[model samples]
Target: MPTIPSLSGLRGRNTRQPAVGRIPVPMSAYVVDCAVYVDGKRLPRRFTHADAIAEVRERGEGFVWIGLFEPDDEQIQGIAETFGLHELAVEDAVCAHQRPKLERYDETLFMVLKTVRYIEHESPTTANEIVETGEIMAFLGRDFVVTVRHGQHSGLHGLRGELEADPERLCSGPAAVLHAIADRIVDSYLAVTDAIEEDIDEIESMVFAPNSPIGAEHIYLMKREVLELRRSVTPLANPLRRLAEGYSPLVPDQVRSYFRDVDDHLTTVSERVGSFDELLTTLVDATLAKITLQQSTDMRKITSWAAIVAVPTMVVGVYGMNFDFMPELHWRFGYPLVMAMILVACLILYRTFRRNRWL
Candidate 1:
């Protein structure tokens, strides 16, 4: 397993501290948790970001992990200064709308990952949104890993606990932490894709069913949601591949193998998202064809009824003209004959339409 470099004798020379006498922003406001780990076990005492790194440097044998949630510029500035984070990276992290990517700044590797969740509702056909997204940014250094999360559902508290339970994996240092985070995120992508598959299946069944109430708008809405999901999952592929191919020294050879696994899972997700977009497009076309067929059927029925009504109207109109020379005006039998003829004509037309399946 990969491990971060030894922190011995580098305390004052390498570690950057926040400026002295600056008004302190309360760390607890945005900081989720901070701890020092030696040989994969977290220290029992809690520490602030500054204290955590300081403790690691003093001991010369451990690394610090700090997690923060949606910190504003002012709130995160101190941690950035202490960790020597690149200004551009810190700005991107604070802004919270970065594309998934990886960049190296001197010795620190900055990475952004988009997190997604499948929203549940009564039906996909009526739901306003199906996928919700968030962002997670990580700054990986020699002896510390800092995570900045930008959404409510993007919390890493559970992941932190899971890592703490497995000391051997956690012992691999900051790179290991980075790998675990990427693995967890890709797993989420798989789960969301599976759930969306179920929804697509439901929609497919409804679209083909006879007299289905499902509309094209519903399919369009789903397409929009799928597009949103695609945006989150697809762009991360190259970044993950880069990490797996040894793009940065911060990621060790052993950890790069783990990243390769993540990259494979991400590729699966990308394919699934692409397939979904295509299938939704088919559904839209199928729905339109069904609508056109229905309209044609309706028009045929209307034309058949109109033809039947025209017979009686023509017969009545002729008799009511009231010309003395008219054949039907003079004889009682003529009126009955004309009425019978109209009835027979209407029946003939009705049966003809029925035989052709127009009514």
Candidate 2:
């Protein structure tokens, strides 16, 4: 088991007055894991937050990786004090309603990444479940990396383990952690993009099916989800680019190249997202057009039937008047003749309508 830094005992030059507008944060037994690694290998002893800082300063080596899962304000405040985090960014992390963005404060870089999980469902429209979202905020200091994750499936425990296994890569310092995390997130963007594309294809097939009853509702539902995905993945491109271009001293020359690859991957994802938006809009229009055409066909059928029935109605209405001199009222064969005429008129009108496709 890894040790979490003892935040309460932290003192001296690193401490500062607590910022105002602080929420009464609950104490969470929520410390996920904390570890100190020097030269890409974990040390054998447990250390508190204060200890980790002291070790990094005294030894002049290694990096601290702290993971937290939805920590309350107090826990976050402790971590912030330990690392000297930006107040606004800390606020965003605590509240968990932030857009994907990056901000740098002096020697540290604060990044907010949105995480998403595709919800598998049979119907896109009525399913009420498609894309589930979460948030992960990373505060990258020269010798430390702290991550706060909110929502389910947002944990990076597996990622930390994987990075540890690849010491050669993790040797790049905290920037390596940043790259791995970005790679993981953008990889998810690709996964989500692919899943959404499949769903869109299904919707298109249903819309074009000869007698399918699919509606615009399904198309719009998918479009909405895609839009949300776009919002989550698009804004972070510039931040990634900056990292790859070596905007900070913390990101080493060796690690900078990896960010470029991540940026390229991001480019692809964002392009597909744009394409998905256009495709959905086209689908929506097509669906509405199909509905309108069907409605028109229905009205034509109804009108034609009414027209054919009017012939008999006219005859009946005329006969309904009790006029003594009406034609066909006196002859015994008159009744049969009038009935035949009515039948003949209806038959002719039906044929005409069928030929013209009105029926």
Local distance difference test, each candidate: 0.93, 0.88
Tens digit of per-residue lDDT, candidate 1, span 230-288: 98988899989999998988888989999999999999999999999999999999999
The per-prediction tally of clashing pairs is: 0, 4
User: Deviation in angstroms for 209 in model 1?
Assistant: 1.9
State which candidate has the highest TM-score: 2
lDDT of 2 at 322: 94
Candidate 2 global TM-score:
0.90
RMSD of each: 13.7, 10.6
Candidate 2 global CA lDDT score: 0.88
Residue 43 lDDT (model 2):
82
lDDT of 1: 0.93
Candidate 2 wrongly placed segments (more than 4 Å): 1-28, 123-126
In the range 1-359, model 2's lDDT, one tens digit per residue, is: 98876876574457776788856544335668888988898887887777887898889988998888888667788789878998888888889989888888888899999999999887765677688999999999999999889988888989989998888887888989989999999999999899888888888898889888788887887888988998998898998898888788888998889999999999999999999999999999999999999999999999999998999999999999999999879999999999999999999999999999997
